[model samples]
Target: MEEEKISELKDKLEREKALLEEELSTVGERDIQNPDDWVAAPAEMDTSESDPSEQADAYEAYGENVGILHNLEIRYKNVRSALTRMEEGTYGVCSVCGELIEKERLEANPAADTCVAHKDEEV
Candidate 1:
């Protein structure tokens, strides 16, 4: 990749990582032992006037936040791995077939490490 495009993508990735961290903080907290790991905020579980329906709502919210946190964590891992690959001078190369990935694919997803052909397959 050209240095200029790499620079632009680096900036975008950094900004995105920052935004992800900020969003994670709102509904989650990083694990003390593993900074890369995040956990959803504990469920509120208010008394809710001893109403079962109200308790169910709180549980639902908790489940939603947990799902969100899981997705963010996965994205965070992918982005981090991409950054590491860039440092290793292997960014934009298909991990499966060892071919240069399409520029359009990289533009769409900087974390992509494989070509369109290998995308749905395991590395």
Candidate 2:
């Protein structure tokens, strides 16, 4: 990739990373042991109501947040990995076929790690 293109992608990736972090912070906290991990904030349960149904609702809400957090964590890690690859000079290569990834694909998603042909394969 040209240095200029790389710089532009770098800026875009950095901006995306910042936005992801901000969104994550609103719904979860970063894991202490693993920097790439994030956990949803525990929902506050108001026990003063003495209603078992309300407690169950809180748990369900918390469960949904956990699911959302897990998805965001995966996306965040992929973005971070892509940024690291950019620094390592392997940013635009397909992980499966070792071919040059399409510029359009990279423009669509800077965190993309594979070409369209190998997009379904494991990273």
Candidate 3:
């Protein structure tokens, strides 16, 4: 990829990284031991004062937040990885095959690690 195009994609990836981190913060916190890992924030509820039904509801909400956090964390990791690839001069290269990834695919997903031909392959 041209330096200018790579720079633009890097900017986009950085913006997405920040947005994902901000959104993750609302429902989770970065792990102390593992900066890349995120743990969902527990729902606020005074278990001692709340009824069993209320406690169950709180747990359910916590579970939902965990699910959301999991997805956001995955995206965050992908964005970070893409940024790293850019720094390493490997951006726009397909991870599954040693070939240049399609520009349109990259435009659609700047964090993509595979070309359209190998997109369905496991990274």
Candidate 4:
């Protein structure tokens, strides 16, 4: 990729990283021992003094947060990995095939680590 294009994508990735962190914070917190890991935040409601229905609601809310946090964590990690790849001079290469990733694919997902042909192969 051209230096200019790479720079543009770098900017996009950085912005996305910040956004992901913000979203992650809304429903989770980073693990103290593993900064890269995020755990879902427990629901804030105090159900101990409340009725059974309130306790159930708290549990349901926690479950929803877990699901949301899981998805956000994946995207956050991918964005971080993409930024690392950029620093290592391998930003636009497909991880699966070692080929230059499609420019459109990069534009569509600046955090992409695989070319179109190998996108499904990426974890």
Candidate 5:
């Protein structure tokens, strides 16, 4: 990639990283024991609501937040890894095949670490 294109992608990745962190903060918190891990924020239950149905609803919402947090955490880690690769001067190389990742693929997903041919392969 040209220096100009790399700079543009770096800016995009940084923007995405910030957005992911913001979204993650809303539903989760960084684990104190593991700085890289994010745990879903537990839903606050209203003690005034003694109804069993209300309690169930609160638990359900917590479950949904857990799911959302899990997904956001995955994307956040991928974006961080891509940024590290960029710093290492290997951002555009496929990890599996050691080939240049397709420009269109990179455009579609700036965090991609593999070419289209090996995109489905486990890293």
Candidate 6:
């Protein structure tokens, strides 16, 4: 990719990375032991005086947060990985085929590490 286009994409990726981190913080917190990992936000409920039904609802919400966090964490990691690749001088290369990734694909997903041909395949 041209340096100018790469710069544009880099800007886009940085914006996305910040947005992902913001969203991740809303539904989860970074694990102190593993900075790269995120855990679901704990429900702030005082069970001592709360009704049984309220406690159950809190648990349900926690479960939903866990699911949402899992998805957000995946995207966050992908964005971070893309940024790392840019620094390593391999930003636009397909991980599986070692070919240049399509521009349109990169435009659609700045964090993409594989070409359309390898979209369904794992790297």
Q: Which candidate number would show the highest TM-score if scored against the true structure?
A: 3
Determine the backbone clash count of candidate 4.
Answer: 0
**TM-score of decoy 6:** 0.95
Tell me how far the alpha carbon of residue 41 in candidate 3 is from the true structure, in angstroms, after superposition: 1.1
How would you encode candidate 3's per-residue C-alpha lDDT over 1-123 as one tens digit per residue? 888999999999999999999999999998999988899999999967869889999999999999999899889999999999999999899998879999999999999999999999935
Question: Residue-wise lDDT of candidate 2 within 1-109, one digit each (tens)?
Answer: 8989988998998999899998888778988998777889888899789798999999998898888888877888888998999889989999988999999999999
Q: What local lDDT does model 5 show for residue 122? A: 33
Q: Could you tell me every candidate's TM-score relative to the true structure?
A: 0.89, 0.92, 0.96, 0.95, 0.94, 0.95
Worst 10 residues of 4 by lDDT: 44-53
Worst 10 residues of 3 by lDDT: 46-55
- Predict model 6's lDDT versus the native: 0.91
Q: After superposition, how far is residue 24 of candidate 6 from its true place, in Å?
A: 0.7
Give residue 35's error in model 1 in angstroms.
Answer: 0.9
How would you encode candidate 4's per-residue C-alpha lDDT over 21-109 as one tens digit per residue? Answer: 99999999999999988999999887458788888898999999999999998899999999999899988999998999999999999
Task: Name the TM-score of candidate 2.
Answer: 0.92
Q: Compared to the true structure, candidate 1 yields what TM-score?
A: 0.89
Quote the lDDT for 27 in model 5.
91
Candidate achieving the largest lDDT = 3
Instruction: Arrange candidates by lDDT, descending.
Output: 3, 4, 6, 5, 2, 1
lDDT of 1 by residue, 21-99 (tens): 9888877999999998899997788774788988889888889999999888888878888888889888888999999
The residue pairs found clashing in candidate 2 are none
Which ranges of candidate 5 are over 4 A from the true structure?
none
